[model samples]
Target: MSKFSFPFFFIVLLVGSSCKEERQNDTAENFTEFVNPFIGTGGHGHTFPGATAPFGMVQPSPDNGTTGWDWCSGYHITDSIISGFGQLHLSGTGIGDLADLLLMPTGKTLDVSLFGTTRDSLPYTSRFSHSSEIASPGYYKVNLESNNIQVELTANEYVSFHKYTYQNTNEPSFVIDLGYAVNWDTPTESSITLESETQIVGYRHSTGWAKNQKVFFVVETSEPIVSSQFMANSETLDSKNEAKGIKTGGQFFFDQDSTKTVEIKIAVSSVSIANAKENLISRGNSISFDEVKSQTNNKWEALLSKIKIETPQDSLKTIFYTALYHTQIAPVLFSDVNGEFRLQNDSIDSTQDWNAYSTLSLWDTFRAENPLLNILQPERANDIVQSMLAYYDEQGRLPVWTLYGNETNTMTGNHGVSVITDTYLKGIRGYNVDKAYEAVRNTMMGDIRGLAPYKKYGYIPYTELDESVTISLEFAYNDWCVAQIAKDLGKEEDYKYFSNRSKAYKYLFDTDTGFMRGKSGDGKSWNEPFDPKFSSHREHTDYTEGNAWQHSWFVLHDVPGFIELHGGNQTFTKKLEQLFTESSEISGENVSADISGLIGQYAHGNEPSHHIAYMFNSAKEPWKTQYWVRQILDTQYTQQPEGLSGNEDCGQMSAWYVFSSLGLYPMNPASAQYEFGSPLFEKATIAISDTKNFTIIAENTSPINKYIQAVKLNGESLQRTYITHTELMTGGTLEFEMGPDPNKNWGI
Candidate 1:
């Protein structure tokens, strides 16, 4: 028997007997302790280090001021000065917006004029050290050196709680900034009113990616407010009615002394102030700070327990759980306690049966994040599809990249179709299938964006629109998703039509260059002066965020057809090899920051090339896929602040990590099959449902054991390159014996 395995039972130990004592001592660490909230706060990770429950709408995190771009989440690890804690924030996104309801603690005697209402100056900001900061899964703490104050933050589903400790100060004040907008955000109107002496209720209307975004909040404090003042653009406002401006906030002085602590709770809603107050009273109050923290941690533990792994490496556990944590940050719960949520039409939805959820980020998430959720969180998956259907009911079409009851129309393709179809095919049937089908077909059949041109010409023409090539390719994949649903629904005619439309990727294939290139509107010839490696900074280009090399293999729905187009597997394998062995340099005049984390021409940082490594399965080179998958897992992710390679893109980047680290990749995200790669852990137990748990064990596994030697499913010999979602849900053990060298005959 291998050192990592037990003889009688199928329990997974370590690789050696010497590590038994080490494992015994490490049993006290909860899964939450392995989560480092700061992993993606630095560099281009674009993740927020905040206190939030799983999929909670409230995110209370310190903002270090923003210069746009890297400050998408309103927080950066490089900045030492924290202006305030924003109740709402973005996670791992390319654009920034929600930094709503900024609250900052200040010394009562501090000069207000020096700071002003804006965070552009001193009094509103304070420098803090990382040494005094503590961040776990659902809690965050930091000390401001300038004010001798300590701030701790925690959250429930819709409400956020703040605890402030003052030392050597008799007077303490909390600044409530209602109109403080972050990057790409402009506040049009805002209002704040002192309801009694201990409560404030208001709303802020802004224009940004979501266009007409409205956020209402109800803030209540444990202490009484002795005095209050309102300001707009740093000037004191005498108007008690409403304050309207780009910069508006309030200052409330509390009756407190030295070494005193005050607690505050804020509940927010997109519907109305009444719902916000209801949310606050129902979910936030009647819970102590420690109880809130404890309950939040318990919620995180319950969520993390869905996928349990036994490993001796602390680094592996940290990275795995952190990646999993990132996957649950978005697709936020948008419904209130009464199932009340705002719709895209600026009206309230009072539906009691279906709950609404926003933050789809469909362009990025349709790749893997939503697919992972289909497996781990099937019920939430159903709710997410229902939420998209709700948007479809509100608007004429499905959401491209939605948030807070608005469609940003960012990125490309009818990708929501991919998410819906993938979720439905995974055997999750909690949504209305007819409505989903209608929404899916409407995205393709509607004459919106470039879909009309794609249908008319079999592909979008470059002269007709920019990014015509990638848009056509993505639309083709989405059409494939629609076709799958059509086939499942017994609509044979629709299935045939959509299936034919799904092959539109072939029109852009420049047979001479073996790359998917752009063609003019007339379809007589390809676009002139085509540089396959060239991409724009952020504007119109032949591709979305990548060049032709990365976009070539994006046809994940038809890798076999792609291989056939290249003659056979031999030529296809050679071309696939070139994607990782070609020139490593990118030569565009103004390249995008998203086109990073490069391994040769294959960019892992962005979503385009995510499934490229796993395509080796179709080329009869699964070992190469294993080698590169392990390489990307080790080199691309880390336990540090700047651990990620690029924008976590909501959670797609981390979803790729979570799926690939477990020795599987959903090559076709809309399909139920998972392509095998190299498993990083010795054992992983997945709780598929309430009554079943699936376990995957790797025997004789180590750092050098990157290839599979043999495999067994529940002690029966297994010989397949893919596993079905149904098989995984049946509750069984999949064991693989690992060796230092490739046993190519095992799965092939």
Candidate 2:
């Protein structure tokens, strides 16, 4: 195992080895101490040195650097200091948001600013030597020297793990206060209600990406403190302190000196106070911390096991599995036990097992990950589609950026339509197809359509509002996917409508310039100089977070058409090669690290380029695909903080790596076809489904023979990059003869 495996396996094994009964399955052995949340607990990583339930929506951790960034997800590798942990962390957010409602333990008067302290002026923050931090996939732990508090934090779906150790000495006390705000907007009203001698519940009205959200939490401790403090503008806090009425923050400390350890349990709700109370009742605090962590790990294992790829190379296997792991982290469950959930319309609704999962950046996932989900996690894909459908039913439109039940509409394009359209075409069963169709249509053609910009202006025109070029290219592709979905359902008019709509990119396609250019509403004049490179589309130029090199190949539904548009195969290949080997001139925009792996302007880090590498298959030049795909796998990704080089983009990046490493890529998800590539392992098999009990295998593969000599499905030769979902689900073996170098005309 590589050095990465130690920490990686430790987290997995700790969670997997939940109890003694399952000791037999604990095959992967390792030696490691408890975790250190303080490790990646700061800087660009956005990780908090706190406990969380695995993949659970509620992440309670300490807030040191509440300033938002991706590293803030849990902890960043860049930060060197130790701060307290808050309960909520938003993973990999480009715009630092949602490290809200911080709870820290301190003895001094409560102060919120972090400016007074410097790296040297305050050594307590850095007193945490790196040797003392323990971090795994599911757990973290560290000790605070300033206060002599040893902290251990982990997760167990919807529950957090916290173990605070107060060393045997004086100042044996702790504090829990709710006055801190985590990117919290001013609440219209705030109130703290006592539930019992040992419990407190309250509501904090705040707004940000998840606007109009009313946060309610129930906190119960293993032991009760002798006293509690409230600061609502000076209302008698204690003999020396008083509740300051309408004060911004308040805190209370534990009075006992003999107590050495303590644990806290909390539950949050977005619906109502009653629902928050119910959320607590559902989890009656009897389960051990180990048990919860173990349970959460098992849940992850079961989910991950749906698609099992067995390869001899541990790194390849680990990377593949880890990529698969990262892919499933989002579209998180946002419902309560009663099937009640917040709707996109912002109304709390009651349903029967119908829940909403948000943070689905489907514009990226539709390339490969969703297709993977349809086959391995069809049930989950169905639920996701159902949730989108439910979003339509409630919000009267499909979602863009959803938090719990709220939709932020952050990004461009309406991909919920394409996802639904593709799901229906793939023959998956989960939601009402008719309702799904209605949603697909409403989102594709909504009066205030997110996609309307593309249709009206031939391409999305960068007006005072909107990402013109990017929205155009993306909408064109999504609209094309919708056209396919429309065709399948025999909605002739809708098919023709979207089919016509899908070609809107052609208007911006400068036949003379041979690039998709941004145009104004007048449609004759193109955006000046039209350089796709160094253009930060985020400023509403033409593209979205990309330059010409990245957006040029956005059309995936019709590669042949795109190649023809580019004036044939040879020129197309030349342009693509330049895209990969060219340099990127940095523009000072928040160009998502997702746009990493710059070859000229071709960024392997983002989604637009995901299919560009595979599009070579369309020209029957499979050798190029093999070369670039292998190169991308080897160099662009690693097993460390800088490892990703881009946003996981809701598993889209991971899914791309997973799919490509398997020697197959999903060019189009709803089509049930995968573009074949060179497999990166000796042997890889997909256990089809439970009822079918079938499997697909790739044999005689290795790093040397990374080029596919030939592929046989079941027992026959294949012509194209695609294989049916049914053929895969029914089970079969895909044998291959890989070689060190390309066979000049091998896959050709």
lDDT of 1 by residue, 1-748 (tens): 0111012111122232233424423346577877778878888999988899999989999888765788999988788889889998889999998888889988765443233234665466888987777788888888998889999999988899999987776678888776566677878888788887788898888888878888999989888877776777667777643455656677778776533788999999998999999998899878878888899889998888788877778668778999999999998989998899987679887655766789889989988899888888887888888888888888888889997889999988888888988888887878778888999998789988898889889999998888888899999999999999999999999999999999998888876788898898777698878777787854668888888888888797898898888888888888888988788777777787788888888888888888988888887778888888888898889876778998998899999999888878888988888888889888888988888888989887777998888778889887787788888888899887888998777766
In model 1, pairs of residues that clash are 4-14
* Cα distance off (Å), candidate 2, residue 291: 1.5
The 0-to-1 C-alpha lDDT of every candidate, in the order given, reads: 0.83, 0.62
lDDT of 2 by residue, 269-374 (tens): 7676677667766763686656665665566556656555555444454556657666665666667666677764557766565555666666667777677777
What does the lDDT come to for candidate 1?
0.83
Stretches of candidate 2 exceeding 4 Å from the true structure: 1-55, 66-74, 106-127, 169-189, 232-249, 344-346, 447-453, 462-466, 587-594, 691-700
Candidate number achieving the greatest TM-score relative to the actual structure: 1
> What TM-score goes with each of the models?
0.95, 0.87
Off by over 4 Å in 1: 1-28, 109-118, 239-246
